[model samples]
Target: MLRAMRYLDYAATTPVLPEVTDAMVAVLTGDFGNPSSVHAYGRAAREIVEDARDRVASAVGASPAEIVFTAGGTEADNLAIKGATRKLRGNGNHVITTAFEHHAVLDTVEWLGHDEFETTVLPVGPDGLVDPAAVAAAVRPSTILVSIMAVNNEIGTAQPLAEIARAVKGANPSTLVHTDAVQMLGNLPVNVHELGLDFAAFSAHKFGGPKGVGFLFARSHAPVEALLHGGGHEGGLRSGTLNVPGLAGLGVAAEIAAKEVDHKIERVGGLRTRLWQGIEDSIERVRLNGHPTERVPGTLNVSFEGADGETLLLLFDAAGIACSAGSACQSGAIDPSHVLLAIGVPREIAKGSVRFSLGRESTDEDVDAVLEVLPGIVESARRVG
Candidate 1:
C-alpha cells in the first residue's frame, strides 16, 4: 500500500485552483482567437485578455494600463531590472540591490555590472533583512535603479520595501525603485502606490494560478525599454501573442487570492506556527530561519543541527511528504543557499535547512502529518549524515 502524500512547498509553486482551471478551460476550448485581430473571434479573445489584465491590476492596486504581461517572474524581473536600467541609463549607470534578492534580480544586476552598469550588491543581517539605512547609504547620484525583493524566497522574511523605497528616494529622488514581488503577491498585501515602487514583478503560480504566466506593474511614469520586439503587444513593452487561457486563469486566481488573503494568512499562519512548535518541542538543536513576526505566513525554513537537508528531503519524500531544500530555481546547485549565507547561517547549517511552505489549502491534518514523522526523519537523516 502507498502512503498518503502530503504537499508542503507552496513557495516553490501552488496547485492551480478549481476555479482557475475552469476559467482556463473555457478560454482554451472556446475563445481561440488572436487578440490583435479585428474579427469577432479576435474581439472575444481580446476581451478575455483585457478582463484578466483588469483583474490582475485590481488585485495589486494597479491600473490595467500599468500591467505588462510576461512569461513569468523571471521575465518580469528582467524587464524591471534590465529594461528599466537600460531606459534610464542616460541619467546614470549605477544600480543597487541586496544579496538576498531572487536570482532573477541578482543575476541580472550582476550581468549588467560586467558591461554598461556599475552595480552595488548590499548585504543582509543574520535575520535575513536588508537595512533601509544601508540602502540609502549605498545610493549615489549616479544610481539609476535599486532593485529589491519584497520577500526573500528562501527564508520567507518580508523586507521593509516601503521604508527602503523611502530611504532610496530620500537619497536620490531621480533613482527608480523595483521590487521582485514574485513571492509576495497573493501571499501578502501588495499595493504598488502604497509601497512607492516604480516597478513590481509577480508570478501567477505563486498565488494558485497556472504556471507560464505573470505580470509586471510599471507605474505610467516609469518607462522600461522593450525586451521583445514584435507586434507591439503590452503597450509595446512586451511583444508576443498573449496566452489567453493562461491570462484567464491568472485573473481568477488573483481575484480569489486577494479576496481571501486575510483568511488564508490567519489560517495558514496558525498551521505554520503549529508545525514549528511541534518540531521545536519534539526535536533538539533546530533553528527557525527568517523573522518570527514579519514574514509571509505560509513559509517556514528550519535548520537541523546535525542532519543533512538533502538527506532529510529525500527521506521525507520516501515518507510521502514533499518539500524543498531551498528555492526551486536552485534545486540542483551544490552551494549552500546564498540567501542563507547572506543571512550568516553557517555553511554546514545552511546545507541542513529545509523550506516548508504552506498554502491556502494547507490544513491542520497536514501539520499533524509532518509532526508525526519529522522527528524520526531527522533522526534517520542525522545518522546517515
Candidate 2:
C-alpha cells in the first residue's frame, strides 16, 4: 500500500468538509436556475443564495446586506482596497499598509501608489506585530484608507485589529479600516462591528468551504465603488452570475465552523505545540519565526540554521510529508520570505524557514508522524545544501 501523506499545509487551503460537499452537490443538482431571472425556479435559487449570505454574515457578525460575494480572498482584497480607495479618493490620496502583506493587498496598493495615491508601507517589529501607535502616527489628514491583514499567512501572527482600527479612527475619523481576514475566520471569531472595521475579506476555501467563492464585509456606511459593472448584481459592487453550488457549500461550512471552531482551536493548538516541542527537543539549531503567544494556534514557522528551505521542502515531500517554504502564492520564488525579512530575520535564516499549518482534521498522529520523520529529513537536507 502507498504511504499516507502527512498533510500540514492547511494555511494554503483546506479540504472541503463532507457536509459542505453534500450541500454543494444538492445545489448543483436541484438549484440550477439563474438567481436574477424572475421565475419560480429563479426564486428558489435566489433563496439558496440569500440564505447562504445570511449564514456567512452570522458567522462573521455582520448583516446579510453587507456581505458582497466575490470570486475568492484575492478578489475580496482587491475590491476592498481598490474599491474603497477609488470611492474615497475625493477625500484624500493617501493610503497606509504594512511592509509584509499578501500580494493581493500589497500589489493593489503598489499599483495605486504608482498612479495618484501617496502610500505608506509601515514596518513590522521583530516579533511580527505591528504597533498601533505607529499606525496612529502614520495617519495624516489626507489618509483615506488603512489596510492590514488580520493574520499573517506565512507566520500565523495575529495583529491587534481592534487596537489598529481604533488608532486609525482616532487619528482621522474619516480614514477607513480594512483587513485581509482570509486566515482569521477558521482560527478566531471575527466580528466586524466589534473590531470597528470598515471592511474585511474572507475566502470560503480557507475554512473548509468550496474554492472560487468568498465575500467582502463592507460595512453599511462604507463608501465602495463597483469593480465589475454589468447587470448590477451584488449591490452593483461585483456583477456576475452567482456560483450557487459554491455558495451553498460556503454556507454549510460557515455554520459548522461557528459551532466547532473553539474545539478545533484547542485541539490544533495542542498538536502544534507538540510538533514544535518535538522539533525543539530533537533538533539542534531551529528557530521559531513568530511571536510565541500572540499567534494563531494552528501554525508553526521554523528555520533550520544550515538547511535550505527549498531542499527541506523537497525532502519532506519525498518522505510523504506536505508543507511549504512560505506562502503558497510565492511557492517557487528564489527570494526569502518578505514577512520573515520584514520581522528582522537574518537573510540566511529567512532562506532556511518552512511553515507547518494544521487544521480541523489534524490530529496527534499527524504530529507524531512529523516528529518521527523531521529530524532525519533536516539532516539529509542540511548535507545536501
Candidate 3:
C-alpha cells in the first residue's frame, strides 16, 4: 500500500483549482477564436479576454487598460525592467534592486550592466528584509528605476514595499518603482497606487490559474516601452495574440482569490504555524529562515544542520511528500540558495535548507503527516552523512 501523498510545494506551483479548470473548458471546447481578428467569432473571443483582463486588474486594484498580458512571470519581469529602463537610459544608467530578488530581476539588472545601464544590488539584513533607509541612501539623482520583489520566493520574507517606495520617491521623485509581485498578488492585498508601485508583474499559475499566462501592471503615468514589436496589441507594449482560454481560466482564478483571500490567508497561515510547530517539536539542530513575523503565511524555509538538503528532499519524495530545497527556479542546481546567503545564513546551514509552502487546499492533516515522518527523514540523512 502507498503512503498518502502530501504536497508542500505550493510556492513552486499550484494545481489549478477545479472551478478555474471548469471555467476554461468552455473557451477550450467552443469559444476559441483569434482575439485579434475583426470578425464576429473574433469579437466574441475579444470579450472573453477583456473580461479576464478586468478580473485580473480588479484583483490588483488597477484599471484593465493598464494590464499587459505576457507569457508568464519571467516574461512580465523582462518587459517591466527592460521596457521601462529603455526609456530611462537617457536620464541615468543606475537602477536599484535587492540582492535577494528573483533571478528574473537579478539577471535582468546584470544584463543592463553589460550595456550602458549600471546596477546597484542592495543588501538585506539578517532578517531577510530590506531596509528602507538603505534604499533611500542608495538612490542617486541618476537612478532611473528601482525594482524590488514584494516577497522573497525562497525565504518567504515580505519586504517593506510601501516604506521602500516612499524612500525611493522621497530621495528621487523621478525614479520609477517596480515590484515582482508574482508571489504576492493572490497571497496578499495588492494595490498599485496604495502600494506606490509604478510597475508590477504577476504569473497566473502562482494563483491557482493556468501557467503560461500572466500580466504586467504599468501605471498610466509611468509608461513602459514595448518589449516586443508587431501588431501593437496590449496598448502597443507587449504584442502577441491573446490566449483566450487561458485568460478565461486566469480571470476566474483571480476573482476567486480576491473574494476569498482573507479567509484563505487565515486558514493557510494556521496550518503553516502547525507545520512549523511540528518540525520544531521533532527535529533538532534546525533553524528557521526568513522574517519571523513579516512573512507570507504559506511559506517556511528551515535549515537542518549536518544533513544534506538534496538528500532530505529525495528522502521526502520517497516518503510521498513533495517539498523543495529552494526556489523552484533553482531546481537541479546544487548551489545553496542566494536568498539564504544574502540573509547571512552560513553556507553549511544554507546547504541543508528545505522550503514548505501551504495553500488554500492544504489541511491540518497534511501538517501532521509531514510532522510524523520528518524526524525519521532527517535522522536517516544525518546517519548517512
lDDT top scorer: 2
Which candidate, 1 or 3, has the higher lDDT?
1
- The TM-score of predicted model 2 comes to 0.98
Q: What is residue 257's positional error in candidate 1, in angstroms?
A: 0.8
RMSD of each: 1.2, 1.1, 1.4
For candidate 2, give the lDDT of residue 142.
97
TM-scores, all models, native as reference: 0.98, 0.98, 0.98
- Any runs in candidate 2 off by more than 4 Å, and if so which? 1-3
Candidate 3 clashing pairs?
Answer: none
- lDDT string for model 1 (156-223, tens) is 99989999999999999999999999988878887999999999999999999999999999998786
lDDT (Cα, tens digit) per residue for candidate 2, span 15-49: 99999999999988888999999999899999999
Model 3 weakest lDDT span, ten residues long: 218-227
Give me the runs in candidate 1 sitting further than 4 Å from their true place.
Answer: 1-3
Q: Which regions in candidate 3 have their CA more than 4 angstroms from the true location?
A: 1-4
lDDT of 3: 0.90
Task: Report lDDT (Cα) of residue 329, candidate 3.
Answer: 90
